[model samples]
Target: MSNAINVKRAAVASLMDQLRADVTEKKLTPQEELAILEKLKVYGRTVAGSDAIYSSEGIIFLAEVASRPDNPDSSREALRCLANALYLDRQTVQYFIDAGYVEKASEAYKSENVDDEFLLGRILFFSTTFSKDDKLLDKWVNEHHLVENNIAAIARHATAYATAASTASSQAVSMMQTMALQDTLKLLYTLTTKLPDVSTTLGPTIPHLLSLLSSIPLQSSPLQPPTHHVLDALSNIPPTTPDSQASYFPTSDPTLHVSKILKILDKAAIPATSATSSRSTTADDFDSRAASLLKLLIEIYPPSPDVVKQLIRDTLLPSEKERSLPLGSQNSATLPARLLRLASSPTTTNTRIILQTLLFVISDEDPVKFVKNVGYGHASGYLMMRGIPIPSEALEEIAAESGEEGGSGKRINPITGQYLDDELKAMEASNVKGLEGMTDEEKEQEAEKLFVLFERLNRTGVINVENPVRTAMQEGRFEEIKSDNEDSDDDDNEAGKGKGKAKA
Candidate 1:
């Protein structure tokens, strides 16, 4: 097997050397170049072939062939080969950069030919994806002014495609145009994330991004390709000033941007779950990106109209039936219920925090209303995590109003935000499997479990609290007992070892 692989590699190396020599001597014809490029393109699709190309300076050869003005067909093929090579073997990226090929490629963005534009965009996208050097990105943004010169024009061209896409059937829009737009957005997102200040100088890119977001037809999945890239790029480029933020929306429809974001969020929330597996990472990405964009818009919108707030309330907050249901029992069919479920999830931390914060904002940032609206069961953890104090008067008012009629004559259970009868039924169901049958040892084990849980919570900065079991032990609340394994346990502890079970 090894001998066969070595022979194949040798043949590939000889071919790469021949291509490099022909390109260097300017002796390769257009037809010959096309045939060699087809082979190079195939070779670049694998790691070993890409490595051979890089070692033989095949990237430089491909770039030279692609830059030949008279051989447009060969140039396109060469660009494809280079793109494949750079993508498959990221080590070729720095080599391409050091060879001054990126600047040459950027100049081609001025060409009216659509194929050249898309191919060059793909190449540039790979450069951004693979290169970690911030100096190069900074030079491209500030010194070269790539954003003003190339990126903005690319956005305009893409915007035209997106606008055309919005009105026409999906098949009518050119796939090449869509791909070019996706690559351009990916390039814009990577650059802005590295140097966010460049977003401020991105002349017409912001509107163009928004246009694409609004125009891009969501497939069976809302988080696919250009839509995902557009949202990601927009979130990283937030408005620098309050006035600038407000300027994005019209006064007549102040909630325009918020409405658009919620539409996406609504779709995203429908499928999100705390039990998401690795296969569902795309759903998680949508939730996180959409939540981030929503948070940015909410933070920037002026407080006057209250229209955006009202719109959010109508869309994301609890429905009429949900307003009366216990938060723990709320159906996940509604957006607010799904968000409430996600807000308590440990895995989706960013989505959780943003959901809680957005909920608080729509509640007028009042502790009492926040608790009253979502119930103490749902609101307490977030309030404690954020260190937002619940006023004594507010708590007292909530307690006083807990069992009120509220026009429905249904007495509310303030802790879980359920009606009194509903809470009683749930309590009865839980007690059917009560802990009364447990032995003293089992009870002690449960207490130790609680102690470990509190210790872990305190350690993680989720909450600050003393272990009640530890405090009880210190207060001499328990009698001591000896264990047969005590000596071995002590030896293990001294050796910095422990079993699967945690010590209290």
Candidate 2:
């Protein structure tokens, strides 16, 4: 037993030495570091004195490691060390915080000399695991002027740490809880306003802010205005901008700010109406803010089909009066039409929502004719079902028109051999003997054949209906079939019961 104990102790010591060496020299791969971390876990649980020595050594090693040039491989190992140290010895972590090692790590963070992933992991460990000795943080902050000298740095570090923690293992929760809400919020507020300054810096901060917004505990009294302040700031930046717009909004690159803003909105709970009167006051302000951002998006980026669809859906099927709009008047039509034109243009890719919106409009009147003339295929069925009057006169006139003298004036139906009226008129004016010899019956037969062929061509494939009429018909028929089958089953059961009773 003594021999076995000695062997285990030696193994633990060996692992600790390796961990220390790796942390100091930055020589370990992330994989090797992870192996060492696993061994530390075992040593932490099974070996005597392992926790004490590891915690002390781990802190020193992390401080040393963080000071090195940025290397993802080495930093990953450093993060593993910080995580283990925080998990194993909270008291030791406080020692580091008290001894000003935390401030040193923070300085490395600001220098942009450390790997972000490692710095994030280290800060997270410090923030969450350091004992609640306010003196430690206060002393460090006062001595280093943390809030004054490095407010931006602190915010950047906190945001990056929070975001990275969120994506890390489940251990991140405890790490996040270590932060003071007031301090964190204040830092976040400062960072949020400086988003335009740090647009390029916003990528890492966004996830962190979103996470903070999600984790913030709602309170009833002394309304938290800072929460709203952060939200408003995020909502102000447009998702898309010209390539020359800003460094953050690189012309060739997609802006992440848009996604970050969307995420913030998704995660934030609307403040309760009864919680404060200010909540009600800000409702319009929130919409106005959102609209401003959206307007910038419209101006800078062509509206996506999904976005256009959403606008149409919201406008047409608004849950509140604020969402709906009258589409009849010209002014009322402006937003929808602009969207439709953008969606309908050949130059535009992905125009499904634009087609849907136009279909809704065409379901009423002359819009159907307009869509057909423009060669849009997705809106046809809706227009047809809504009994949109296709202007036959206009169609005939268009068919009769000739482009130029040298051009073939005759517009022959591709599906049928019938010439358009314009074509026939041109032929007649040219006094073509072949057309003059045709009898009225022949002309009538040709017209009927042309109508059948054109109609079939329009329905089956040739003319692209914006929304195919057959699709609507098929859906209606399927529903009808299902209902009829259910009714038939019911009728059969009733008849069977009646026969059984009569026989009895």
Candidate 3:
């Protein structure tokens, strides 16, 4: 028995040396390091020692190994160990945090390898939220003092995950993408919420955020990864703070337009998805958060008067489904068209909030311009749905004199859209451009191109744009629509518990 014990101790010593070399210096391959880790894990469970992975040096080696730039596979393995230690040994974890391991891992998280990205993000998630060394984070931010926010590390990984999710072929890849996204969001949320003063990180993070949001599917299921956190971080960020300045609307021309982002949000919130392919709960949370951000954005940057026509052109007219509808039909199916759709629906109170935003944006232009361009029916109907009173001045222009007394200035019929003859004529005149000479198939194709116009010229609804009434319809009246993927919330809660559970 004594001879057998001596042999096992010798083997353990050799394995420990290998592990130490792997962490202290880049002397071992990824495979070698993993093998050592496995051996140490098995031995450490059976025997307690001052130099084992459960000790201070063990954590130091793991943190150093995690931030390695040469071998991401090894780095990821090391990160997993550190994250486990995050919940196991607070004294060791704090020593690591104070040594700046959290920030170093954060910077390394920008790794091109998706696996490395996931692990690094997990490190940030636990370290910032669970370990939560605020002093370390503050000092780290000061050390890497950026003149501008350079969150490219996290941003690149975020964009990479989104891009990969689009082309993922296998279920494993899909799951990885899901995890990568959720982990990144969690880390970002923790940073913004816990260290709101860390503006250097958030500055470069904004553009990538917009890019990611622009790519999300509309109507995501609530079971998907809670995407709402992104919006929460954005909405909570102080706009004037230095950290907030990086995301601020450019003061100069060619700036990030309010209408531009609104259009992106419009597409994301309502993106057409195939019926068979299910949306996850995280996606639904994202949509909710996105809508909230949209509310904040609309409040800060209502569409610019200079770009009003462009907003209508890009968002309402040329979108995918809107194209198939007749120009008259297209009019009522647009962004403005949907505003009426939502406001009239009993399902949500976002209507009141959305209505006020639309009113403020369109308020800059004359109603007649909208009537002639988008058709009086669509524009007027949307105003009516929001309970805003129609302006008599604009109404007079669309309604021809009945010439009969008490004929209540000819209201457009709501169902058939019949009333705006003059506006329809004007719309058709501009619409008939290429068809001035084409015929047969040529005219057919030309007509298809003109799908950008409203569905029907004849339509009825209130024409009110002046001094609109604003109300937050969802306020106290609505609850979030629940999703079928409630298990995800349970799973996430379980994961959170893993972080806060008692140390070993």
Candidate 4:
């Protein structure tokens, strides 16, 4: 078995060497280059099954080729071989880290030129994915301008991708252009989401992203996926206060911050109210992207209750309530209603969490207020669609089994009961007093808020609203978001304050 593995590894090594030689000597023509890459990519999978492959010299050889200057096509192929080899293998990730692949790849990425956009993007993408600890990431985030560099690379590649894709008459070139755009956007998404305080990193790219987002025609197949990621990346960029403190459940401004974002959002939202609405992936993708774009827009500007309410109401109630079209038929739901329904779930697909966070914060957990203020019928419809508990008559109806009428039996939810008990216990331990001097109606009104209602209801089933900080952390939000102020005390402690006097 060991000898067989060694032979296979040798075969892979020889293949890598030949590819490198071809690139170095400029021996391979474009057609030959592509053909060889296809062979390497296919061969990579066959040999990837061997544990010995990762430790062999071939792996490093590929990394060097990938990082080599002025060979974008070959570089991409080299990177793709490694990616295919490493896909879903923990051993591959660990071996890459231990063998210093991350550092080497980072160096290559740092030295890469504009033409090496796809190659550079993959380097940053894979390196970050394989980084076992914060040592490298800290260096990039703190001292090195990785965020700045990444945005530049993305913008450069995107402009090229857009241009090539638009003008290229050849199907192959167009396909390559599509792949390039998708990869670039995905890389940007990975960078911003993984890096802390990333919104600040995207200042230069936002205008370009806004322009791209605005240009995407509704349900346009060629553009949606890449455009989708651009919006996804934007939403994932955390909102920040002037002091760099993370905004927890940030608000949306009435104007949606920039006029461009607002306009793009309007364009994207067009599909939600189209004549054909079946909630398919294309539709869902557009809806989700639109929701995420709205989230980023809202978080940038302080949210207005009126604006949110109007947004929901517009979705809930169409311009003509008594239309001739069949109910819930083609494009029955307006943009806000479609997005509201989508946002009710804390699913990652649609930036629903961001929208949910904004709404929950602004609504303050009152379902009744959300209905009365936002669009009672529409809001209720959205909640019911999600099966989220509302803690009112609407709640009973939502929780009740469909088609079962007449009995007034309360829904028995053991999980919800346990959660409420946990909340009560927490409140008692904190010695907080509430509902003592309140009437039932006042208490009901208080319970009706969207914020309170979400706490009681688990739309995503992954969140415990009473412990939002922990929930947020589990969802990969930065711990810094948990704090309103930077840990100046910790810095002071590090600098020696109360424990010992500082030397002048």
Query: What TM-score, over all chains together, does every model reach?
Result: 0.74, 0.29, 0.45, 0.54
Runs in model 3 deviating more than 4 A are: 1-33, 36-72, 81-100, 107-114, 129-135, 144-150, 154-186, 189-201, 205-289, 303-305, 308-334, 341-504
lDDT of 1: 0.65
Angstrom error of the Cα, residue 224, model 2: value is 21
TM-score order, best first, reads 1, 4, 3, 2
Q: Estimate, for each residue in 184-291, the C-alpha lDDT of model 2 and write its tens digit.
A: 344434433432444443433444344444443333321234345345434444333332244233345334344433333322212214334443433333332333
Which candidate number has the best TM-score? 1
For model 4, the stretches where C-alpha displacement exceeds 4 angstroms are 1-10, 13-38, 46-53, 68-76, 88-90, 110-115, 141-145, 157-178, 202-204, 215-223, 238-279, 283-291, 297-333, 337-369, 373-504
Task: Output the lDDT of residue 114, model 4.
Answer: 40
Best by lDDT: 1
Ranking by lDDT: 1, 4, 3, 2
Tens digits of per-residue lDDT, candidate 4, 384-490, equal 55655554433221222335442123331222211223345555678854455455444333433423335434545523234332233355442221222334553
Question: Residues 202-284, candidate 1, lDDT per residue (tens digit)?
Answer: 53566666666666665556666777777777766665544445545657677766676677776775444435444265556
Query: Candidate 4 at 131: error in angstroms?
Result: 2.1
Clashing pairs in 2: 243-251, 377-465, 377-466, 378-466, 378-467, 379-466, 379-467, 400-422
| Candidate 2 lDDT trough over 10 residues, lowest sum | 495-504
Please give the lDDT score for candidate 2: 0.42
The predictions' CA RMSDs to the true structure, in order, are 9.2, 21.1, 19.7, 19.2
